[model samples]
Target: MATGANGQVGHELLRALTDISRDPDPHPYPSPGGRGVQCISPLPPGEGGAKRRVRGRPCEIIPAARNGTLENGTACERIDLADLDGLPRALDRIAPDLIVNAAAYTAVDRAEDETALALRINGDAVDVLGAWAKQHDARVVHYSTDYVFDGSATQPYREHDATHPVSAYGRSKLAGEIALRDSGARHLIFRTAWVYAARGHNFLRTMLRLGAERDELRVVDDQTGAPTPARLIAEVTALAIAQWTDDAAPLRDGVYHLVAAGQTSWCGFARAIFEHAQRAGLIERAPAVQAIRTSDYPTKAVRPAYSVLDTTKLRDAFGVALPDWQVGLDGVIAELANTRFMNREK
Candidate 1:
């Protein structure tokens, strides 16, 4: 079951899972040994000289969210993580073997005022899910953020790096991580940075809207991280889950950094969005994006100055190769353009 199914990553995950379930790639991953290929689909008879045949079966996607309905009018199970008392009953009713907890209290700045509310959903709720998963012997897949670390590192952050969250939202997320670990449940916590998508309230969509209306925009250049697309995150998650299905190549549970390759400041990211938007006819003219320091635009929540995450561990473990940040951005732009063109025709 996928929680927060209407969210940016959650929506993409539904699509990715459907696609993989219907027609799984025979060899979808690189071998951890490097250079060799790994197979996730059904092994053919007498091929590769393997004794056992690994087959991927169709997956049943039970989308659970607070709304209990998708934008496209699809009905889903209602799940309110904030309701701590009802959480276990909801999970019991759903009875999912693999719980993908994509839901979270994502109001970063607002978290300062509502720390308890944020902790209830982001921290305490995850504890319930983790304990339930542990008792039922089910697996869990949870998404985390780079905010767990303070912006002090000059180099890319590894999984084992020290965590020093500076804001209430970060602390809440860190609490969830700790709760899940303490539960002793089999879980994969993916820490991603600067996530956005073609749709939804994200940096990409915000840039497109602002670039069209404004002639100039001031953006922060001090903070740095990868602009990871939601679709890429979903695709990688599906691949990782597939690896777990393969008895010959089961994945170990741990936290891993899942983001697009390469890094850039917010100013650079905004500039790239406008650049791609102009080429895709998303904007008639690109705006002049002014680079400014973090202090120029302050918010309630303090952001990490540098949150670039190293993907070496993720790559070495899952044999998944992430595309460059620019590549992912280009694809999202194309998607936005296609949607625009279709709407115009209608």
Candidate 2:
């Protein structure tokens, strides 16, 4: 089950899994089938469903209540990762075969002031979950970030490359990876960069809103990385999981870099957003997007200058080739536009 099901990756994962589970033989593009696939609750008989039997005591630290049932009848319990004392009992009860840790302390700039909180949640709690998973014999899929590297490399980073995180958030996430490695449990760690979704508060949404509201926008141009879609990550995660179940070996229980196929700077991504919005008539006029350096726009924490990760391992190992960043960006924009249009109708 997914831990951060309400977050960007979690939300899309829920949708994609629901779609696949419903139609195992669905076309790559399912429109020709005339039957649209979507996530549905109270799954059809013989389909897997989550119940109280799957989740134990819940602990939510993200302010929102931690209880809900997915369309597939999977009863999701959002628990605060920091509450280590209560986790063992919860794990004992849930008895999950696979635990996908999509939850993370992702406030990059704020993490400078909240380093302890970041470590507690991102580092310490991962150890706790890893230990629990080992005892329960459950496999884990953990999410990581490109910031784990210092971003000094002119070339893309391989999975086995040395990591020297420059920020508190990055260090903490790196620590989590170390903990998972030491735990001796089967684990898959995916390190991604510049992640965004159509539904969430991401760079794409922010740019779309600001491009329409302002006459000019200044974005950092020096930093370069793939702008990955959360939906694509979710889909790839599922594919990896399927591979794991198929062979359990050769999947290599270690880190893999997952991102969109191509790389782009923040300025380039912003320009693409505005251009797509203008083409789709979501905005009448695209604003001028000015390029700036990281030094020009200072923040609480230092960011990586170039965080592009090499996806050759994932491609060679899993045969999972990610779509281009522009293609993923277009899909996100279409989803956003469709969502907005549907909301307006209601």
Candidate 3:
């Protein structure tokens, strides 16, 4: 089962599963033969929409059939993380073999203002779910962020480095990691950074829109990290799960960084986006990209100046390597083009 089904990672996970199911030689692990995978979480409200509260009621389960399939093959059920009282009922109903927890409070600046809500979802809810996984004897794949580090180190962060979060969002996510580790469930926690996708509201999409609408764009250059694609993260996650399921003896359990290879600052990233969009004919010209320090942005929360994480541990353990940032960016832009064409058809 997958939590945060509508999230960037969750959305891609569903799509990757569909692709895997259609492959001629599917992996032995998900036990394919039409066995369904269930996703749990509400559809995130649209931008600027009021958040909906789910009381202690039976979750609304949406069928997750393949794109062109004839029958319902997978499903995603909406559950409220705040309402722990209703969790037992939801778990009993699903009885999933594997649980992927990709849901979290990701608002970096807003998390400072909503500390209680952030702790409730990122910290307390994780403990609740981890405990449930322990009870059900199921494996869990939890998603984390790069903000856990303070960005002081010069080199790429290793899995064993100390986490000293500079922002409330980072602190809350670190708390979740602690909870997951303490829960005694077989789990894999991935600490990724600068995640983006074509469908979601991310840096790439924002830059493409702003670069088209304006002639000049100033982006932060102080912060540095890898730009991980949501699709690549999803694919690597599936491979990790397959390995864990097949060879339980050599299972990789603990925190590992899963990000695209190479690194770039926010300003450089914006410049790349504009360049790509201009080449794709999505925009008339590349905007004049100006590089500014983090102080210029004046955000409520302090961001890490350098949060580059080393993925050697993940590579050594899982034998999986992430492609370079540019390759991933190209794939995302291509996907965006396809999505635009598909939308035009409708």
Candidate 4:
């Protein structure tokens, strides 16, 4: 079952898993004939009639969200993570062997005042998921954030580094991580940074909106991390899921850093977005983006000065190569151009 099915990552997960599940081979990627790029672009329905199975059974994906319907108009199982008392019962009714959790309370600055609500959804609810997974002998795939760190490191953070969250949102996510780790359930915790997609309310979209409305914009330049695409994250997750039943792949349960290959500050990311948007005709000209210090744009929550994550462990374990941040950004821009650029705000 996939939680947060209506969300950015969750929506992509549904597509990726659906694409892979239609393949006859259990190991869908790293194709023997060496044409694996097809896996990145989703195939039209009935294009590949072959059925992919997990452990000798047909693969079925049950997507759950707070709403009963997805943005794409597909029905899903309704599940609200904040409803703590009903979580276990919902899981029991679904009885999925594998759970992919993409849901969380992601409001960073708002979490400062709503600390308890953030903890309930991100921390306590995750504890419930972990405990249920353990008792039911189910495997879990959970998404985590880079905010668990205090941004004190000059270098990229490794999986084993000590975490000192500097904000309430960060603390809540860290609590989830610890709870999942101690729960003794088979799980893969992916720590990613600066996630965005073409369709969601994220930095890329925000930048485009601001650029269209005003000629000048100021963005923070000190904080640095890779801007990861939600599509790439979902595809990599699909690869990991494919390895779950493959003896040769040898899936290991642990925490891993998953993000694009390069680092950039928020200012740099905004500049790149405008550049791409202009080229894609989403904007007629690139706006003037002024670089500013984090102090210039203070929020209720404290953001880490730097939160780049090292992906050496994920590469060594999964045998997957992540594209550069710019490359991913280009793809998303191209997608937006083809689908929604003409309709977008001028």
Which numbered prediction scores highest in TM-score against the true structure? 1
TM-score of each: 0.91, 0.86, 0.84, 0.90
Return the candidate ranking by lDDT, descending: 1, 4, 2, 3
Q: How many backbone clashes does candidate 3 have?
A: 0
- Per residue, candidate 3 scores C-alpha lDDT tens digits across 272-298 of 887776677666788899999888889
What are the lDDT figures for the candidates, one per model? 0.84, 0.76, 0.74, 0.84
Estimate the overall C-alpha local distance difference test score of candidate 4: 0.84
lDDT of 2 by residue, 1-346 (tens): 6677777887776655555445443432233213222111122333432221112223221111135554355656746677778767776766677778887889999999999999988999889888988888878889999999999999999999999999999999999999998998889999999999887678888887787689999999999999998988887776566456445453468899999888899999999998987777677899999999999999998899998999877765565456678877777777777787898999
- Candidate 1 structure, TM-score to reference: 0.91
Give the poorly placed runs of model 1, Cα more than 4 Å off. Answer: 26-55, 247-251
Query: What RMSD, rounded to one decimal, does every model reach?
Result: 5.2, 7.5, 10.6, 5.7
Q: How far is candidate 2 from the true structure (C-alpha RMSD, Å)?
A: 7.5
Cα RMSD for candidate 1?
5.2
Q: Model 4 — which ten-residue stretch has the worst lDDT?
A: 32-41
lDDT of 4 by residue, 267-339 (tens): 9999999988888776788889999999999899998888899987877666665768988898788878867
- Lowest summed lDDT across 10 adjacent residues in model 3 is found at 33-42
